[model samples]
Target: MQQTAYLPLALALAGMLLSGPVLAHSEQHAAQHSAAIVKEQKPWGIAGEPGQVSRTIEIGMSDQMRFSPDQLEVMQGETIRFVHRNQGKLLHEFVLGTQADLDAHAALMAKFPGMQHDEPYMAHVAPGQSGEIIWTFNRAGEFDFACLIAGHYQAGMVGRIRVLTN
Candidate 1:
């Protein structure tokens, strides 16, 4: 009779232990997602407001590790909606940053393959899906975008953006 009574309590303890990591992961993801929504200014630009978007650009990602129309031109101070379509069978991401920043990030990604990050200037797209990043090119200079998913960046999945002075 005592063993039967403890059975339910033991199962509850096991459930709690098993759920601890899952809950922590969920909380971490929520925090990251929330932080991403906060608009922050970068040397390249700030997170764009939908109402201020000047135009939309569609870019394609494929298993070949290339972005279609990889070279892009944008006028400084223009807000653009970047639509990333993943036509590949694997997950991909579009991250905009300076070349130095990208190189450092790619190295980190290679070291920690399971690292999860969410930023206003990045979009993670799943296979056959799409993602978007609205950004304002407030600075005039050259910039870069790439898939910093471990081996993806090494495979030449990169693009260039020239923010021309207006």
Candidate 2:
């Protein structure tokens, strides 16, 4: 019959139209996955805009109850590369937050392993070991970094971070 005669032509036209968009979509998806793989291999960082001002600083914590430099000053909204080295016999945490925040969190820390050192904002460095953290203190305030190893902070192991006005 006349209707059945156009079956082959209709099928061919439908396949051609579908293939065009399908091929383009598959190629775009492949490119996106490739780009994501490259990003995963990079170092620790605070996400920011292009050409943003930033700097890296090395901080060391020791058993002697101290953080090297004692006090740190940074510009508001600037990135800080924190490299923490623990030269102490016990585990140490390089936490950045207000003094009250540290104190409040300290009590609940014993529930977790490594003193919550595995947080994205902190890198727990064991004795004689090294690690890094990327922190951006976007506001001007006083933050205290301490090794809340029970008696550590009480023995004066706390340090100060001063983020300057914008």
Clashes of each: 0, 0
Best of the candidates, lDDT:
1
The model with the greatest TM-score is 1
TM-score of each model, in listed order: 0.81, 0.63
* Candidate no. 1 TM-score: 0.81
Candidate 1 regions exceeding 4 Å error are 1-29
Candidate 1: tens digits of C-alpha lDDT, residues 74-99: 99999999999999999999999999
What lDDT would candidate 1 get against the real structure? 0.91
lDDT value for model 2: 0.67
Candidate 2 residue spans exceeding 4 A from truth: 1-53, 110-117
- Per-residue lDDT, model 1, residue 17, is 85
For 39-158, candidate 2 gives per-residue lDDT tens digits of: 221122233333453887888888888889779888877877778888888777776666786786565453332322244455667889988766666667677787776667778878
lDDT of 1 at 131: 95
